[model samples]
Target chain A: MPLSIVYYAKEFFRGEWARKFLAAKTAPLVTPTYFRNYPELTGKTCTHHLFCMMACPAPGAIDVVRTPEGWMPRIHVGHCIRCGLCVEACPNGVLRSGRILESMFYDNTKLSFSFRIDVDTERCMGCGNCAVACPVNKLIDSQMSHGGRASTDDLLLKVNEGKCQVLHVEKCTGCKTCEHHCPNEAIHVARLLEAVHAPEDEL
Target chain B: MTVLQSLKNFVRSKSIHVAYVDVGSCNGCDIEVLACLAPRYDIEQYGIFVHNNPREADVLLVIGAYTPGWEGKLEGLWEKIPDPKVAIAIGNCPISGCLFNRPHTLVDPPVAKHIPIAAQVPGCPPRPTEILSAILSVAPTVFKDYEVRK
Candidate 1:
């Protein structure tokens, strides 16, 4: 054959061809990047000091944008390191650090989805208000727990007996009834402003 | 069907420059709006560009509930924006002030009472797609309105 053809064949075998041939033998699992979820909850009496923006370490992760009301913190998901600093800085427990499956993140543009509630375990006084107020709580079968022994209703009423624990986060609709009804303000519901999805085009 | 109409449609569909203005809104709608500029939503795919200056904007996106002091400033900004422009009120703040519409000293009236809203996207924080669609739907009407006036 020709010398150029031989050379080109050699280069392909050494570079992309070798990788593709090897890939046929063993496929590697590509780990999706995990995003630290921050619920963008807005409330009636929020002080709006924007200390969360101040606490962020990553540049452009949390930007302070001035609206007509006042300055508010806006998170840039692309730049966010998911360090959870902004969540810690929020005095009102407005921000909560959670993990979201980047691939499982849905588009809220078509159908609106609220953020799941994150309970500050330390702050929770085992108040059963969240359990009682939860709309999904009624759906949770009481017999599902403890070898089909204890009912959810019994557990909810006695929720304050020990410590309030968030049993099922996925079941939460982000209705924020628990957050609203909580006297101690232990529960913080996530407010989703942007749709969570892998970027279509990476800039 | 006609040459002039086709020419106008081509220009209208070619590019849309949007300027986002927040009066008294929680940063929720702003975040959603900014997401459209990000790689995920990427409104640029539709030839829509989020511009900073009102002078170059084809569409003015006014987000937030109106407050007392900002009336003069907002009106001034509105005046600065050139004609044949569409104004979209994104999120509940501009429409009804959402939760902030409480009878209080700081809260003002809605944006509709001040500047004429060509379109309204109502949500506590409207989805980026909703905002995008609202802009698309209203842009043609705004252009047609301008053409009629001329």
Candidate 2:
């Protein structure tokens, strides 16, 4: 069977053993590479400090704090699955795994960036999943009504004639929940300034 | 024989080395394996070492299944590992072609067809402890003399 070809390769060539030897030789190299690339001890300071603040549920209270250093992550320690969703989400290599754990355990105070989502008033559906998922309620109600309790009519959604021909006068919070959650990348948060400026410039 | 003696005996032998290959996997399993190395699971205390090179590995622990772009590379790497080597298919993709499995799929070939698998560890990605157990069971002789000195 063609499937047996793999077994044939393993048995006849002893390829598995060779790979092990090669790995043994290379294991030492990986360490040096990691250190040279990351350089934990040098203590080179980060110029830009962004905090990805998270709110943790206390015994009875919710405690919110900004992460002092590194890439601002959406999740916290007990809550992190190490799935790397936040890591991948980071455009900068601010949020990293592996040895970063060692540094975090040693020094709890490090400067970092906090990612804050600003929604365009014209394009948000006001679904509060992002607010709910936010570990530190950073994405809270910018408006008076809380928990996506804004007037639907007040929220304006814009349609790009070239991009999305279909128009809907839907209620939007400009909270960016729809833009962030839209799997198809079809929805975009419309900037309030851009919409207001367009008609004024035309006049 | 008592479990302690059996454990003792298992540590005395020098067994096989395992190497892992990531072929377009989402890397969920990779993170779990790394976690196993941490203080929590501590698979290293049992004598299993994860290797990078394919030539010296006694066992090939493959994490992902075939994608069209990566098929040839996987085959090439599989050929490089020396034998008497056992292939341990880990994760649902290699065994049953889990999420990425489709008839007209880009990288559709099941891992079993690509190599001669000696054992299978099933899970979306099996827990590291489970992976360690699978490795030990397949190559008991190599691990007979294993001792992890803290």
Q: State each model's TM-score restricted to chain B.
A: 0.89, 0.78
Q: Which residue segments of model 1 deviate by more than 4 Å? A: A1-203, B145-150
Each prediction's Cα lDDT score?
0.64, 0.49
In candidate 2, position B56 carries an lDDT of: 82
Identify the leading candidate in terms of DockQ: 2
Estimate candidate 1's RMSD in Å. Answer: 18.2
Candidate 2: true interface contacts recovered: 0.00
Would you estimate the TM-scores of all the predictions?
0.43, 0.37
Reference-based lDDT, residue A127, model 1: 47
lDDT of 1 by residue, A1-203 (tens): 69999998888878677766533232322323343444464542335645565555544567667677655667654345455666545545445455322213333111123356677778877647667666566566433332222345333222534566666665665557778888898878875534324334321
Lowest summed lDDT across 10 adjacent residues in model 1 chain A is found at: A102-111
Model number with the top lDDT: 1
What's the CA error at residue B100 for candidate 1, in Å?
0.9
For candidate 2 chain B, which ten residues in a row score worst on lDDT?
B141-150
Docking class of 2: incorrect
